[model samples]
Target: MEEKFDLLPLLEYIPPSSLDYLEWVSVGMALKHEGYDFHDWDVWSQADSRYNAHEMESKWASLGHNGGQPVTGAFITMKAKENGWLSRQYEGDGMETFGWDDEISYERDYRFVDKAWVEGKEIQEPGDNWNPVEQLQTYIQTLFSNDDHIGYVVDSWQREDGKYSVRGSGVYTKTAEEILNDLEKYKDQKDLGWAVGDSKKEAGAWIRFNPLDGKGVKNENVTDFKFALVESDNMSLEKQNAIMRELELPIAALVYSGGKSVHAIVKVEAANYAEYQKRVEYLYKICNKNGLQVDSQNKNPSRLSRMPGVIRGEHKQFLIDTNIGKSSWEEWHEWIEDLNDDLPEFESLAGMFEEDPQLAPVLIDNVLRRGHKMLIAGPSKAGKSFALMEMSISIAEGLPWFGFNCERGKVLYINMELDRPSAYKRFKDIYQGMGIKPANIQNIHVWNMRGHSIPMDKLTPKLIRRAQKEKFDAVIIDPIYKVLTGSENDAEQMAKFTNNFDKVAAELGTSVIYCHHHSKGAQGGKSSMDRSSGSGVFARDPDAILDLIELEVTDSLRDMQGKRATANFYAEKIRDENPSYLNEIGQDDFLSAAEMRKHLAAALGDDRAWQISGFELGEVQKRVKLQTAWRLEGTLREFPKFEPVNLWFNYPLHVHDEVGVLKDLDYVGTDKPYNQRKAAVKSRDSAEKKAERKKKTTDELISAFSILDEGDGVVRIGKLESYFEKSRNTIKNWLKNQDVLMIDEEGFVSMRLELD
Candidate 1:
């Protein structure tokens, strides 16, 4: 008869106590439906404290199929899944096979080896120069520390089939130190049996890979939970060695079993028994997936492995290698996962040389490309956030952003630094200020993550999943510091953090645009790429970087702007009341206050013009004073370099300088060398000192005359000396060159009058 189906292995994952009565009954019914015998169910049920020995067998027999549909093995599989049992398939000679209904889906591929590409490595036995005592001592020292209790079985009994098997659980009371000492003491005799115990030559020996507590030989008695055994007898020995090396399993010791299999003690380094079980399961799953057929029965912590330096009938079970793979379990696991990442495969450049490969479409005309990244960096209150919001609107409405045309498509604005209401109002304000209608308002999506923002590493996947179906052309993140994951100055950490943006852009097929702040200093002298406040990776990683630097608006420019604004205010008032008056005024006349007043008199009559002349025009002057000038420099990867664009931040919007008003303005420090800047500052200070001294002398003389004058508009020189803090002669000489004052030899001072 065919072997009874084994449900016991899967039952290890599903504890009976975790199940309710109905779920428990379902398990038994499914077991019966799958043709498993009653004994299997009874044995597994006994693990729960509620199990009644007498009722279990009767309950199992009564789980026969009724008139309704019978529960199949899928129920058992589902319960296993709920309890962390992954559904995996193994393909090799003599490995357990899954039925047609097994739901096989691996969350990630852990396979690091290919069977067809494996180059088998042959194992060579030691010649007449072999030392059994040294081999045994090395194996023991590599696996255990001095304080760890060692378990090894040497004695065995012959089975009825003439094959030898281990007789007992072996000795668990000896420490590794004692075993090594004994081996060294008996080295001169060359007798391995005297150090531990004599073993049957036919069975070789067995030793537990993990250290025990010196009190028992069960899984619970294991202390360190360190190593696990990986052995396979169904495949060629040479192939197993090659696959094990290819997978880079962290092996503490590797021993040939004198038979078809090789025993590899793999370092799991789990903290507890529970963690040990999980790690071993993961190790086995990875091994099986990679074409190394590991024996599933060797998973227990107390399971015995082949003891090296021992004889088994006509062959020797000898140590092959130690510390042969990765240094630690964590390092090895990371290497495997990185090797199997879901990155795209490589293609030969020669294959596409004959034809031009298509590039990602342009998202921001002449600045950035679709499915790429762009960074906008500037100082605080430079309207960086406003610029990003305007870009979003521009993309949605098919308009221009900072003089660059944008492709019209769906866009997502992730607001990480604003409250929900403020964010909504800002979008509306931008729309009104830009004078763009809401023709494609539906294309603009606002995800107000404000208070709920998380790190970029954790948020990127969620962003991808949500925006995958939106078919967006761009994703704009305002102020990246809210979700930045690591120190901005650390290149390694920032690289990992910024890679999340790449993931989002690649997964969603959208351009990712974000804003950052400039480094704390004058940004005039630094390159555009070096001005962002972070590691240089931030400057180099993106496809395009746009930097904003403040420009020094000269006093003359401000005065010019005030006059032009005042004239425009008058022109607008006349245009509103008398439309024909604009035709009478020339274009240059609108830029002059006198010309605008003459036009206003003709347009609205003298009474209205007089009323308009008295108007304060304070609001217009305030608008001019509040205006901030900036120069935008670009470092683009996909396009040719363009001239720097100048802008004016006029409250709610950044308006491009169309008439080159800001073209002559320079950044705060200019681009001069440090020494040159210092010299210019010194020269400016010297000139200012001369003008200030002349003004001070004139004020003192005028004040002294006013205080000493007795309605005659003249003051005595002796009284002026008290204010001058100098001699009378010095006071007289100081007034000799004054154009506004006349001093006589009699020591009296009077005002100087013009001859005209």
Candidate 2:
């Protein structure tokens, strides 16, 4: 048999005025629920908080159940340990009959009250009662039927007749039966009570339940049902129940709060914060339609309710149920997920476009449009967060970003990596740099979730609820990798994560910007989609994806920090609409000059004999591949002051004598002169075809010179000029050039050209 102590029937036998009796009752209920034999424990019979082990043994020896029965502390502890509830034992003061171990404490230890265990125990029917104690006990049992969390406050109201009406207004804990038994014993203690409604706080008008803090088996975990109490000034319980029944709400229990009002304890089985808000809103609207009074202020999740099982004024509050069984949270979640069906009636696409004149249906502005998702990707420690911070402020402040008009509205930036202090410092730095006061930047809320990586499933509902509470134009989640628990490379998992954000955007009508990391290596060669690490879902799913690449350090461009300043901001995928923002801003040209200079400084190291041939310049330019030639030319103009030298083939080489500067390049037959080459400007000829033509021309010239040199060892420059059908000066210059022939001071030339 399960050793059970029926504390309910014993309530009538115990005096209501004794505090010691009440405490003993509480201890006994807790002990009995854990299947412990408390009757033989004589220490519990005394009112003192502490009892000696010696006295416990003596009392156990004298007690009826202890006659030849094992009732000593040692036996009880051994039995407790055998049950696997006790972790270890310690020898403390001999007076300590039962207490928690100072070195370590376990939840199931005798000292710690497992309220959930107590609440789940089978109800023990009370004995025949003829006193007020039994009356109050029975009434208390009837009041808190569902075992919801409650609080209490002793309050007095001034009546119309001028007499003060006093009562205990309170709520109950998870173990309402156990707590209620103890509460009745303290009826004489003025204003003594339990937590009213769903919380342990005072409730003036109506009780409110905190959705995040429901009374569940795990006290710390959120419960499925959020209780909402309806209170009225001049409403009867019958009338309130009638209206509640008419609304067909999921009523867990109804309680009589006090004289003129009733508390309809409606329950909403919400899976998350967003569903909780929706359910409560729906409840409020339904109650109002039925002409029942409900305090709108009580709609907040943290609002308090009246404590069940407490005597108020002249009457005992009793719970009434509509006989509907408890709703399953799994089913309720499905119902809420189907809430999309209740969305406003649809309108034609053309009609929606016509309704909004200046605004497009989807695109709000250049930065981010309504109903669209954006990705801001960069390498780690590449100032991605800082760039996003500026963007967030711009959107919040209605300021232009990169010359793109920002659709001003409230923004939320969720930082999952940096600590609050570090994030704040960065924000301050950006604000000061922009010459904008922190206070001037409005509607931008920052949530620094350091050390906590909340997954998308858990994070989405919170963001949705927050957006619902206060309409947000955009929500930026920095370093999305931190909060994303799934594998980035897994297409299915990544798609699900991104789809969640898309849902948030669609539901809240707010744009979401996901700050992400790019894969290692320079981003210049790869397309924006390929640059981002992860499955293609991350790149393909978003409406717009932006890549910030640190351009390779080159000769002509250096960044503001005297480093390579060129950062390529690519609008990798801009779907459909072409916002002027992408076209108006040219970051490559804007920062290329500085970047080129920085690159040159690094490449020109050990400048001895450093020469820049047109071919070499063309090779560097090909790598840089900036759209415009002006950046290259501008960087070239900044080179160390040097005179142009005409070398082999009359090639112009900029000769710099300074160390660490490019020196004169050796003239080669294949190298074209600087003035003769169109290295910077784009050419009409294909590179392959141009190479072929140049080879043919060189062969023809060499053959012609070879034929002319057959008559003599040296050829006259004038004869060659006439034979080649070229000008005399041109021929003379060609003779003096390095590639053609060796010329003597006598004006004679050896035309036997050695062609490379």
Candidate 3:
């Protein structure tokens, strides 16, 4: 009554009612009691109709049977479209296939060769032996016959083997000569290559590639990946051959890759390695953009026929029960059950998350602003030390961090392990990227003195005192091991260092961030502070704690060169006990409108002004606050964005307080006039130190007259002086007796223009 399929392989096509992506487990369990193994069981399913049981029920109803008898199952899916084939197709075989298709289902197994292959192997798979040779014939005839494009890009992902390997995805295209010749066009000038790669394949999709021609050595980390057949369900018009797309031909080519990680090779011979790497990463982007996901974890040992959690937990019992079902092996059932009980649970940690989630909460989850203390810990090479160095430099310079705002403050990084030059070189890369000038790089200071032999107790307070005097706002003690020598387990010793560190910070008002390492065997449920190798010392000593967990990733770049790897931050404690800052839960010092305006005006290099007028504090606040400008607490004489607000705090013109920045700033007198206030100093009327020139005029006139009356014709200009000394110019002018007209220029008081 139904239209029979006409193609030869149509009969070989497994019914959809039998096998499904989610039906394998129940089918596995159904075959559990019989055969040497579940793989011996068989069913047939069409790829499209495997998971619909409702249609099978209707079919059985038409047969005048109740629900007892199983019917071929199927699924009917349709989107909002004018499809001409307004019909449902059914396909399935065997009890599992003929049964209902719900979220839970056992697979439909069919086809003689497929059954044979499943029987031969411990596990059954749809792609195991689906007529590979026959499918190959179909593929070449249907898809490749008339194709003009000689190559195809293949992307493969495997859950095992902890390596993110890559290779030429463009399958065997032109001859090696042609490929090399094309890339050689850039030979006139050495330029970086392009980028390719799907985002799923690597962290960032850009890579480097040169000619595979007789130049670089062969890439050793090369391999082929086998994937399940669902990868090609969605194909673009550009991807499919015209012949393949037109005929509605079954194009069932598998997902395979012949790729190698050319990272090292690319690095070696690259004209510009960074550019080339970016180019290779571009390839992966195209692959994924083409609607492809090759996430196929290996399914070895087959899925547990029962609940996975149960089967693994009671593997021994399942084995014993399996053996008991064998008619001849029934007598050894007790022995098998006991043997099964002793069997260890099969665990494959190949693709499991390497870092602990519990600890992630303790790591830096949000942002880390300047003036924050954190105790970072992990094993050696776990990046504890390197991270401290990087963080110190970054915070000090106010460099961009993971796209958040950076605040610059003087970071006194004291490290015993690394040399100063080595650490400074690392800072160069980050500093340059931010477009910050070197002279403004004063925020980052790597102390040269190594603390190799200094015991924690012997570490003098003078070290931090000098740094405080130098105006460093932050201190970093890299690796707590450097200063600590005695019992790390002793809470008393740890408390001492913690107390001292806290004391120094309080006295100096500097944030002190410490670093330590994690103990071995720390895994799930380990708290960050818990991982510190010594006896809870790190926990007691710092205000914040960030854990470092290195999860094994399959990224080639991360595997080799990325030392200071993926990191996180956490704020465990906020020891805001500094009395100076206490009860003062307020924002950091920010410039008022007038202050910012004045600073910006001064910095823009305009000179010769009256009282620095026209700069409104409220108006300047409106723009910077509305626009969200950079920090400039320091270095504001240049209108710097680095620590923008800091320039206002310590600037001589402004004093910061809770009520908002008090702006009646006085000049911080210097032997030399303030360079920034040159115009103000220049415009100032000299010899005006006296209060009310009128009040002092008469006294000075009387004094001058008295002096003149007692003098020999005239008084020396240098002789008459106030309790406050007068300059020679002041004395000459005063003694000249301009008001009373009594004194002369050379300090000779001669009667000149006398008062009436």
Task: Evaluate all candidate structures by whole-model CA lDDT and list the values in order.
Answer: 0.84, 0.50, 0.36
54-168, model 2: which lDDT tens digit per residue?
Answer: 5555533333442343222232232223222322323464221222221221122212222223222121222222232333344335334445443333455555444443344
> Residues 425-482, candidate 1, lDDT per residue (tens digit)?
9989989998878899999999999889899887886686567567889999988999
Candidate 3's residue-wise lDDT over 1-756, tens digit each? 945322222212222232334333333232232222422323322233233444433432233133443323221211000111112234453112111122221111111111112211121122322332232223223222232222222233433433332334433333333333433443333211211112232311211122222222223211111111112222231232221222121222322121211011001112343433343332212222222211111111111011000111112101100111112212222433344353467755764466443321111223332334567665655444545655665566565432334466677777777777766665675445434566656667777656344765555454643554565666788766778856778887777767667655655566667777667673323534576787775665555555544332224422221211110000001122122322232222121333323333333334421223245423433333322101111111112233112112111011112232212222222232223355555456443444357557757666565654554455554455542277876656654434553554455554454458
Cα RMSDs, all models: 16.7, 28.4, 34.2
Lowest lDDT sum, 10 consecutive residues, model 1, at: 97-106
TM-score attained by model 3? 0.25
Q: Which stretches of model 3 miss by more than 4 angstroms?
A: 1-372, 402-404, 429-439, 555-756
Candidate 1 lDDT for residue 362 = 86
Q: Please state the error at residue 448 of candidate 1 in Å.
A: 1.6
Best by lDDT: 1
- Position 408, candidate 2: lDDT: 68
Cα error of candidate 1 at position 370, Å: 1.0
| Cα error of candidate 2 at position 629, Å | 17
Error of 3 at 627 (Å): 38
Residue 36, candidate 3: Cα error in Å is 99
